[model samples]
Target chain A: MNALRNAALVAVVAVAIVLQAVVLRYVSVDGVVPNLALVLVVVVAVSRGSQFAAVFGFGAGLLLDLAPPADHVAGRWALALVVVGYLAGRVRQDARESPVASVLLVGAMSFVGTSVFALSGVLLQDGALPVDLTLRVLAISVLWDLMLAPFVVPPLLRLVDRLGSDEVAAARPVSLARTS
Target chain B: MRRRRFGQGPTHDGSRRVLGLLVLAALTVITLDARAGDGSPIDPARAAVGSLFGPVESTTAAVTRPFADAISSFRTNKSLRGDVATLAAENSRLRGEVSTDPLDRQRLAELDGLTRTAAETGYSLVGARVIAIGPVQSFTRSVTIDVGTSSGVTKNMTVLNNDGLVGRVVQATSSTATVLLIVDTESVVGARLGTNSEIGFLRGRGSIADSGRLDLELVDNAVVPSGGDVVVTWGSQNGVPYVAGIPIGRVESVVSSPRQSSRIAVIVPFVDFSALDVVGVVVPQGTTGDRPVISTPTGKADR
Candidate 1:
């Protein structure tokens, strides 16, 4: 069961990466595509807690870094997402309690993630995009992620809820039954 | 109950430690990649990931293409409507020209226009479809094509569409290669003015959203390129990265200031980098044996 759940998590992240790389290109606004993979990491963080989110974020981030057409340094996304995951996971309790908070957390973390990634680019001098353009990309991405958060977070959380229930019921029936 | 399983399973300090470890690992990887430069050890891992996900990306691109087409069509519906009259006029003119010219001559002319630079320069062209775009997180503008080393594509080969110069092949695997678009901030192409052949260097401004213009600075200060002047690639030594005489774009406007010695012209590129789909890779002359010939514009049957 644990192995199956882990596999499911990997599959979800992979699908998000693929969609971001492929499908999202068509829906881009002014050449700025939304960060679907970052949203997934936030969802994972809010639902699964810090340790799991960090590990998942690292794996997802590494995949994104190595993904084709990615000409930047290998670990830039990994570095940004690790911090994003840790921060989002720290607020997991608040996020779980209130849908609004979870959405807000996703929005906030989107900014952090985008900013971190852009800042890394500036530091490494990866691409010669001017500061204003970088900030413009940052603002647009945050808006994109913010608008996408509500649609993504709730459904994914519910799905994660259903996936967790099977394991939770088997592991600790007494506590889960009482809570329900 | 769910909270207990995850939150309480690992102590708070344990999770913090994990985060620190992951962050450190990421930093180490970044430093290693940066220091290694061209021969980075992470390249093999990157290639492995590319090969693994390349098929998935290609499949997804194929499946989602119609929807993408619909969305793009809807977005461009207004502009498309405006273009209808202009296209109609041009069509009639072309029809008149076709009737006046012999059928064979017209066909050759059409082929010549389609592969203008390649045909004129005698390059063998291998066409490929764009599979996926670069991740938005990276500021670099690049696209993955469906052809690779298997199709005789190698790094630094000039890529172009029917319109004009696209970019160059940066990395090539077995079945896919990444083309770094000419509009990327990091891209620099040696260019020459269409009129007097004044030499200049064109650098991308990296703004695909608004203007998508490139900055052209001539080596000689006195040469002033007027508006509407055309630009083409100044051939490299062996044409490894860029071939000569390929249409880049027309100079839209010139930026002249008293303090600056040389004239800076903003060129709007011929190829639309945003809407890249099918593009051709310029295969070298002698290496055309293995790959099936798509088009040999130079009138050569086989090299």
Candidate 2:
């Protein structure tokens, strides 16, 4: 059962990364690709807890870092997503189980995650991308992530709840029973 | 305040500890990867991931491409058809002019480049479909092409579309190649203005949010290119990365005050980067001992 769940998680991450790279890229608004992986981490964290979120974030980030044309110091994303996942998990523990609240949390976390990633790039001397450009991308990405959250996060939560992860079940009862 | 209390509770300490350890591990990986200086330790893992994921991405792209094309065609098909008809008429008229001026060296030189670049320069081009884009919010502009080392693609080879220079190949696995688009902030190309031939360098603005723009820096501050002047690649050592005479963009507007000692112009690139479908990788002809460098309009060797 554990092996099956792990395999399923890996499959989910792979599919999210692939869709982000292939489909979401072409459907970008002015070049800002919607970060499905960011939303996935946030959704999983909010659905589960810090332990599960942190572990999943690390796995997703490692896969993303290893992806070609990564163009930054490896593991910067892992560090950033670790913080994002933990923070979202904290929010999940405290906040009400409302879609609007979840959207707000996701948006806020997306901004923080993008900022941390950018900051790591700068500190690591990755490249000489201007500061203004980085901030603009962060802003657009936040808006895009929010716009996509309503569609992605709710459905994904529903799917995971149906898949019946014990960690997810103990953390929060399935509130998205009618999302699909 | 209630949330703050829960966050600080004894049970939460374990979560915090887990977070700390994860962050430490990530930082350690970053430090080791950076200091290692060659590449990451997980290169084999990376290659495996690429091999596995690349095909799935390509399949998805294939399935969605027709739908994307249909949507685009629905929006622009009428106007595009009209334009095509107009261009056809103009081409026939140009053909008459070319025949009449067959001996005109200037017209012939211009026509030579249009006929076949592979014939003109010894760089053979391998056509590839753009399968996926880099899925991050960072300044790295890269795309995955269906072709790879299996199709003779190599790292640092130039990629271009019909409009102009795209970028260079950064990584090529067996069945996939990753291209770093010229729009990447870190991308810099040696370029020159069309009208005055003033040499300069064109750098990518690096934001997909602000596409079709590059930062142009001139070597000579005294020479300012007029608005609408074309920018073309200035070529590099043996043109391994970038070849000569490929259109980069047009000057949209000039930045930097004339008196302040900086000449910077905003360039609108010719290629529609956001809608990239197919591209070509320029690989030098095998068995041909070094071809002569092509000359620019200003009578300077592009290399």
Candidate 3:
């Protein structure tokens, strides 16, 4: 199928956004909401490449940032998402044979992104996180991201393939195990 | 014969090294941030990102307002009329209970000042609507308001509603300003005991289960009067964003251990954050303005 033919991609992203704004806001299970958009971005980006993923990730994260009340300077979400999507794209490249590999990859990427957020937050604000609170939040975010990967990635992949979504669909994931 | 890795590619090792280094750097930050040090060049970056995203956030709120209203209609609609009725009933009951019983002159003066200040600043009734909250409550401590930099809102400006202080603005864009609520763990404000002149610092503790506990770092925890000690912003500092004496909450309970030099007192914020709709962004009127005074419903100054 030509990548540009499907309306499902936009639908999927819109669904993801709605879920994020409405559903997840109402139901926060242990303060951990599923990262549906991240799942989509990772799945598509891996099939595609960092360049496309980075741009889309920035835009998507910007949406999430806007969804929240603004109290700080902007662009943190953009930076976070670009890094997450691009990195996850690389991870997808590393895990072709095993679906479990993808889970682990997504989990690690999610943890990294969350950690970066927490770090930046603490630095910007004047406070510290207790061990238990930190552990709970991290555990929940990583698990949520990973759990969502299977659900969001396949649809995302199909969407990209249908929409001819930039180069992310045409390009394969890149492995980072070897040296330059 | 030498064999080459097919999909791994020539740059694979470089990517691995870079990824490893990035991971290590991230870990270092996590460690430092955990201990509460300025996490290495992180603040400027966060501020920068927050600044850039402000406009996009405001536009999104403007676009999505209708959808949000529909979604929250049930939650908000029923409560509004109910709240009005309940408040009217309570007001009638209170008026019957106490006409005037030789009120503490100081308390009377404070309440008079509060009313006067409310009338004078025109800030007493300035209203802002909550635009959006983060998808997850834990990771974020902010919400967008209709008011913005254009509305004379700026960073470090304190927000208030009927109950008292809400939170403070950390950044501002042209049409919208973001406010970080007082319950965010990172929030720090200068507060003190209302009963006595005992001063302390207020810190947010992120849990509703704790029912809005504010950590008190008191200079004189000993002098802090017991139960009836109403906590208010210690608005005495110049350039201090929060005005002195805006009511925060009363001291709920206090505990001290043998090893502890400072006692921890949990406070309940005056504002009911969950039901918040309209709020005032209290631009600290500094010493140039009249000081706000606080009074408690109960006359007790001691536990």
Residue B99 accuracy (lDDT) in model 3: 29
Candidates 2 and 3: which is better by TM-score? 2
B1-303: candidate 2 lDDT, tens digit per residue: 242543544447788889999999899888977777655675666677777777787898889664444333333334532132343345445443433332235335433443255454455667677888885485578889987776667778888776778899877777788888888877889998988889898888675543558989999988877899999988888776888877888999888875878889889998878767657777665421122332223333323
Which residue pairs show collisions in model 1? none
Say which candidate scores most in TM-score.
1
Model 3: lDDT of residue B165: 76
lDDT of 3 at B107: 35
Docking class of 1: acceptable
Question: In candidate 3 chain B, where is summed lDDT lowest over 10 consecutive residues?
Answer: B286-295
B177-290 in candidate 1: lDDT tens per residue?
A: 888888888889999999999999999877665478899999998888999999999989889799888899999998887797668999999887777776788887645634
Quick one: ranking by TM-score, best first? 1, 2, 3
The 10-residue segment of model 1 chain B with minimum total lDDT is B79-88
Interface RMSD of 2: 4.8
iRMSD, per candidate, in listed order: 4.2, 4.8, 7.5
Candidates 1 and 2: which is better by TM-score?
A: 1
Better of 1 and 3 by lDDT: 1
lDDT of 1 by residue, A135-158 (tens): 887887888788777767877765
Model 3 fnat value: 0.19
